[model samples]
Target: MLKGFLHHYYAFGLKVTSDWALPCSQRVQPTFATLEFRKQQAAFFAARVPRALRSQDPARIHYHDLEDGSRYLKWRGVFEFLISPDSQVVFGHSLDGAPAAAFRSYMLGHVFSYALLGFGIETFHATCVVVDGEAIAFLGDSARGKSTLAAAFLADGAELVTDDFLVLGREGKGYIAYPGLPRIKLYRSMSKHLLPARKGQRFTPGRVPKYLYPMEPVTKPQPLRAFYSLVSPDAIKSQTEVRIEALAPRQAYLEITENTFNVRVQTRERLESQFRWATEVVTRVPVKRLSYPRTLKVLPEVIAAVRADLQASR
Candidate 1:
């Protein structure tokens, strides 16, 4: 249980109050915030969680669905999060003597996505940027250059909307993409090429180290204009050209389904709901396949192709 004073921050279109300092834009305390993060002992929260409903990743993470619609998520050697049914409050505890940075990483990444799911918000495993008053999303699997592409756009003065977790909310006839944490992760080599002057903090320090490059985040939500599903040049036989191809509605729906964030919380009802939501999104918005050579030298051309395609659509 959290006592005393709390810090308030804004991200993912929600006002969050936390007992710890979060890597988000600070905001004035609202009368009623949308989410609260509380620090608690492991045993305190564990006693409240139900038995393990299932384990999403046996070696990495375990998930438990509480009786009152809340969720309990445990990441091996990292942290445990007990989220309220309404997704309004989160109780967290570090596990296996994990560092504070590691705990914060999981909280902002997977645990945050879980709360968004509980809030009935549609999300994707993509990075987004604001271009010409509209939001463009790049959807792909890990290491498929989504962040690298977004970094390229940011270098060209495009404002970053979100990275890794793209949150969407229905607004009138269209959808709005909300801002996430104001950072993008990129490889050291890519960072040197794209943002040479900016020194970023090491996110994953290993053989292939990734740096978290900070950027000016889009403060307001932007209207979602299009989604580009990134495909590697190697994926296509004998392909070396940068091209944009429109996806049929069915294909678009499947792409969105596959790129949804946090598949562990996807129950039968949630899947059905997602199917319907994805159907609507595909019918209304354009989803295209963007294939380009995986090299830093080709990024500008890739950006130009994307801009031309967006303009052509409009």
Candidate 2:
């Protein structure tokens, strides 16, 4: 641990201590931290070469696995994160004078998700929310409106559990979804439509920027109830009505596996274990296909349909 003054935070069921300010709940003197983030000298990373490169894009973002069990992630011309073998400590170095917000954007996202995988947590690329005391997750590909629907849920009085990265742990016969960072990323048009009163900070700069809006987070884990795999209406011609269809166990397992985070790093043994784990999950939790038109006007209707589905299942 690089010692000076460290900030303690709690997220995804882990107590974290970091040299930088994390956008999570702060805890004073946390007992037995589960993870630590420290700043390391650039020369430290410069001296080491990657043993196995995992990512396809070397110029943008690359994932490297070292022979010593440590992993390095580099965002070209921005920042890099080195995660310890035990996944307990993360050392970061900024490159090209990147701003603090940029560093944090990658840290809370890619870095944190990678660490969760190392810790043996089942991580998924999904946005989750709390509804009637149970956790509901929305899973889909990019531009499928998972975040937009989640933002709509938030406006309809649902609590944000996590956005983009969800970690699950076994609890009793079911799984519990842990709380993630207390922010949601939305496109500018969606931000204006759903959160008109709230001012959003642009985390990624581009011609079309995604804005991050901070919301009150659900600190405690909630029982995982259902998984909704969103289907774009454009894929189904003339499909105007929102539809929810229950998936069979085999299909559910496949869907979950497809949405799992950090699949490239998994060994054969790990992959087999994950397959079994996902099978067990689908046997307990329900997975459904949620299809609807990609439009803001029908958001309320979509939310009502989901609530009805959940209620009917219960």
Candidate 3:
């Protein structure tokens, strides 16, 4: 008999069969949905076609549509996930190491975001923090300091709402945001600079050099207060201090759509639904461009600038 590990994350109960325990999630009854792991199969998927959604990392992903109407994803050396149209059961296996090797694989990409996307859920590559009883999100490209800025806010007494994968849903007049796993991934340099005393376990020790620090996460969902696109003008040789500029609804809508996770694989119906949701979200929530000098020394000033802006808005 497979005894499932009960976990509560993103407002759902999960009975995960893998050794994937997020320190921040609450232990609950094993009555919820289950994600089982099995041995990896080499002949599980069909041939790789000449054309598919290709990222810079060629082996990052290879998606296929089988003759039997099944969808398969070969995610590099991580794992292959097979999901049915109903989006209920997900079967996964690690490409290397033991069955538990899929633990980090699922944590990195497979489990929540991909599974939710299968169900047509709208998720973004962003981190969120609760301020004044409302949620504020920071979205940006990789290594653009989304997590760095989030760490700054976490140091300054703001509670973390989510990290990396932000889940959004329609709730009455506005949208409600759910918290991801209660953790933040930070680089060694930033962790030492911002949180010198805080010890974090290494996430991708030699390869990524990032550490995962467990956070005291907010339990309930909160209405989104604002969303910001964190950018650094210093990359283009422009000297600018911390600044927050309100983005026009049109621009904000575009940014929101672009930052959506796994957008390439979305069906036409899912894309249309996301368009409607993003349109409504931008109209009500304040979307701004948060530009600041790209330097570690000014992070405190950047955090203060954001705090002042949020206060003045209220």
Q: What TM-score would each prediction reach against the true structure?
A: 0.93, 0.92, 0.82
Candidate 2 residue 151 Cα shift, in angstroms, is 1.2
> Per-residue CA lDDT of candidate 2, range 1-314, in tens?
34664787888778888889888877332222388889887777766644334233557888777889998998887888899999988989888799889888788878887887777666788999999888999998777788999999999889998998888888899988888888999988998889888788888788998888988878778899999998865696678889999999889999999988666666776787788889888998999999988889989999999999999998
Q: Give the whole-model CA lDDT for all candidates, comma-separated.
A: 0.84, 0.84, 0.68
Residue lDDT tens for model 3, 64-145: 5555544566666666666655555555556665344245635444455656665657778889998767788999877778
State the local distance difference test value for candidate 3. Answer: 0.68
- Give the poorly placed runs of model 1, Cα more than 4 Å off: 27-33, 50-58
Off by over 4 Å in 3: 1-24, 27-58, 66-70, 98-111, 205-208, 232-236
297, model 3: CA deviation in Å?
A: 2.5
Residue 78's lDDT in candidate 2:
80
